[model samples]
Target: MSPNTSAGSKQHLAHSHAHEEDIPGTVNLNAAEGDDTGYGQALFPVPAEDPNDPLQWSNFKKTMILIICSFYSFLANAALIGPSPYIDLWAEEFDISPTKASELISYPNLAFGFGSLIFVPLYLKIGRRPVMLISLIIFCAGIIGASQCTTYGGLMAARVIHGFGSCVCEALPVQLVNDIFFLHERGERIGYYTVCLCLGTFASLPAGYILAGGYGWRLFFYVEFAFGAALLVLAFLFVEETSYDRKSAILMSMPATESEKASEVMGSQVLAEISETRIPPRKSFAKTLSLWGRVDNDVPFFTMMARSFTYFLVPQALWVIASFGINIGLLALAYSYTFPILITSPPYNWTVINSGLFAIAAVVGYALAVPFTSSSDRLAAYFTKRNNGIREAEMRLGVMLPAMLIGPAGIILYGVVAEKSLHWVLYFVGGALSYFAAYFYFSFTLAYAVDSYHSNTSEMLIAMNLGKQYVLPNIALILPL
Candidate 1:
């Protein structure tokens, strides 16, 4: 057969298999008729014919965007949590209680989440690229402003501004993943983003070392400012608008069958008319760089915000929020604040600077877990194959079970060691175990949630950010008390 004929035959077969449904919360990946990316036999939410379809972009372009957004997630989170080592220093300088000083981190963390309510809807209505750019600019400005703040109030204000601005960092990366990647790729890709986000907690280690050098807390913000500025430029240059209206795309329809075509010659004419109406010409690079995207008239911004609150009722979304909150609030924040004080006390008598070294355990934990980032994706794919190409969202969640217990155990270990003044190494072991488990929970739960739900992803993200932020700060505050 001719090469064109072979290709057409394969495409037709792929289309025939595409309409088959898997169990709820799953996708069919029996791409026996299509291209295989190694993880699956087929694609879900199949690519559009337009070259501008994000899934159709070259792997290099996709990787670049992922790298940029992942880096942004890193910076935003680092800026939020990196200041933990400075709580004591700030308290001494500002003549406030340690709790008050910690509030600087806690309150800003709240803003970090609340920022999404505004930006998520704005992106849904306007475009992801523009909102990201605007947020980065605001983030850079806030960082710069923070570095110059001499007063406690001034610094807090600056932190809040940056926190709110960079808040989209949490949600945007996931949205971009949903927009650009295939279902098979989402779990692995989100794992990469989650790794970066988790690594941001390690920033406290370096932040402590910087202050130990007597460079001061403000210097940390200065460094953040520099990176934020660089990231802003990179994002503007590389992150294209991914907010396509798939409903209006012609390729969203199923392929016409030969039998249907044979029934009427006018069927072909009708298909052509539909394609013409649905597909627009791909925009040039320069046009894509334009500050504006065509506003989506169907997106109701306020209604989206209102509906986001309802996602809290979703089991998967609630799980994600709980996973993040417990990890961040009870485990991470608790350890960051307490370890310094405990270690620097008489029994341990470690240098104040060395307190942040506890984050090294976090580093080790995440580094170890990094290799398993794709485990859920692989597992889901495996289960899909066994189920005759039917994939379930629950298939990816089995990996999370081990993490669920491991995290709390580590937290308990840390508490016991701290309470008993046991060997300092026990602290590290506890932290490492907790963080290792946290990695699985963080990466897979979010992936599972996304896979399970096919609704407005941005709204779900808003709900997640809000839920975690609200729950985390209260936990952080209570733990410190």
Candidate 2:
């Protein structure tokens, strides 16, 4: 009582202490007297102090990686679909029915989807680089295997192996782009990647003629094998591991490695105290490749998978209907199946390999889309800022509206031209129009889904990829093709 009363009696001392403690721009709340509503919080939580945060990656670094990965996807997918024009040749050579020979493409596609079930999870657990490198090796091996195969069964097995390996390319790029880019940036970046992917379709068309140019079908696989091997080596050197824990950036600044437990202990204590904060941490290329990152202990893989299923229930998700339907319908079925037959059959009487010209249409379509590649991102960002830093999930949809009409129109035109045996230019024009329209939908819708459902992107991509890929070729495209 003597000491406490003496301190209380020192009014000037107390006032000075109180004045010093009451600093400007500071908030003081009595936790014991009020409910903790977490009113004082950042609008967007800054990433934890992790050097390995994808956000910490430089724009140029991210772009290079994106380009490489997208290119791999383009080559792998091109290799798979490029051989569609050779179906007639396979049928004749193997002495199998065209229906039987078509199984070469269909069965491999099935393997493509299932390969994700293994590789996607493994990438999440191990690191994207390792899985991608392994996949490229397998892809090259499969291509080499296919080049040597003499029997239809052997060729089918080799194609399946290659399809399985290429499957990771689809998931990894979307995942990597998501990992590195922001909400506003996703549409354009994805658009760029989508264009590369679509170009693969065109690139493969030339392979049909390559088969006809005296090199045979074996040359197509051999050429693809060389590209796949080159990409594999590039991936091992460039596509480093991306998994990281963001919480340990502070205590680990001593130029010494810290245990995960120590990092977590300090991170939790500091996190509990900060009401509003900004984090800056040391960065390095090596950190980007570490298989450790900030843990969101709240989320689990199965929970993430479960939550992503709800995206399929969304309206915009459903709206992708006509775009993907028509695009895949035309590329895989109409152009892939029909063009080859039409070009090689009666009136047209074109060579069996000339079926690849449809790919030129695909190329023209994608190239035309180049100017507008940045439009969606810019539009979304503008609208987001106008909304006072609030980003609506649907704002990006505006850019896609133009595409809706464009894609459907292309499909109808292509259908009519094919039905009437119209001039081949009409086919290319219709295909380009349809392909360009589909490009907007692919990039924007994917960006929308990623933004609306920020968590569990990989799982959503899995469902999306598996569902569309399986259903389109099997059901919708099959009818038209």
Candidate 3:
């Protein structure tokens, strides 16, 4: 195992209340005799002997949930970054310097990070479904408000409101993926979520085209509002509450045969099925649609927020913070802040609409990288089988090596080409490569962190999100404004 993976795994094992997962991210992947060998391993987190456990949910249900959350990530981020090309235009309109107008995006972004401080803990308290629904409502309201605002200050306020509300869109998918999926499926599933999140940053391209098409900037927010409203409906219909508290059930059916002994993730010999107690039936659709679900009054809201500060000491958690923050600073910022300025300036004189083409390049880069989304999962599985079912969080990190090298090259290329005023294609090449690398780092490092530490997922996220947004050590907390 890589040092980082070993560290995370050791941390995971140390903190785990269950004995079965003694190795971090490690689980018995081998199926019991007569059971389907699709994953070839025992499920981790040892699903409760209850249908209501998110783990026991059918694939279709899990899939619909993933889709809803992924689209939420897309919708929230598109609105956040989509207005990038408007900096100059807004400057002209507001009778201010481009620097002042840039706050339209920057302050909203700052709010975006700050939102996680509140929402992650809120979800932990009120349950994911109600919080998600309420958040979407806030997001939609902000979008419509943005569309109607004529003053710079009014628009800024609207943007910040939506940004704060939409902030959970980033944290929820990872939380949900961990909540619903098994260890075997996490790396690949996170890939799917990561790709959508990356693509949303490209929303600037379409935003620019909308402006160029003569409907103007406000139309972009209107379009976003329509999409946000539609997503709210889909979320209500499909995104069931995933915050399940799976308690340990008494084991029942262990010795039908030696070969039939199911893998148990909890300590000691346990059966795959539960004993004695009556299992609760699955919630009905109408019940699932109810506004509220599980509420953990025990989870001290403010205390949870305060405890997040401790994760700063964890090496694995810090890696994710640095990885996300630097990528956000370097590539995302470069593309959003600098691309339009460069493309529309002296040498190229391209129209602002054409500046959005940089997003196309980012899309291409992410598309090329998307094929590798499952590579880490497959590679880790392969290595797990080799290691006698002991999977390290670092097992999937090998795939990130290529990305690490490729990402820096892309950053360097974009920077140098911009300095020399060289070919624009080279700049696009740089943007694509940087983001291509970003996808891997974003997905896998986070997976590693969660894999390393079994519980405290919400607190860990609080640390990660806040650290990335407001607390990078030497870097400016927000965007480099």
Candidate 3 residue 417 Cα shift, in angstroms, is 3.8
Cα lDDT tens digits, model 1, 1-481, are: 1111234323211121333354456666675544444464676665655667776665777888999999999998899989987888889998999989988988888899888989999988888888999999999989999888888999999999999999999998999899888776788899999989988867878887786777888888889988988888888778898887654554454353333455365676676566445444666777778787557888998999999999888787887898788877766668767888999997989886667688788888888889988889888888888989877888988888888788889889999998889999999999999989988878888888888775567888999999987887788668746
lDDT of 1: 0.80
lDDT digits (tens) for residues 355-423 of candidate 2: 666777877887888889878767765665565444566767898888878888988898898788888
- Candidate 1 positional error at 137, Å: 0.8
Candidate 2 matches the true fold with a TM-score of: 0.77
Which sections of candidate 3 miss by over 4 Å? 1-19, 22-31, 34-38, 92-96, 248-278, 337-349, 415-422, 471-481
TM-score each candidate: 0.88, 0.77, 0.85
Please tell me which predicted candidate would have the highest lDDT against the true structure: 1
Error of 2 at 109 (Å): 0.9
RMSD of each: 4.5, 12.2, 7.3
Query: Between candidates 1 and 3, which one is better according to TM-score?
Result: 1
TM-score of model 1 (CA atoms)? 0.88
Candidate 1 residue pairs that clash? 26-391, 31-41, 31-42
Pairs that collide in candidate 2 are: 244-292, 244-293, 244-294, 245-292, 245-293, 245-294, 246-294
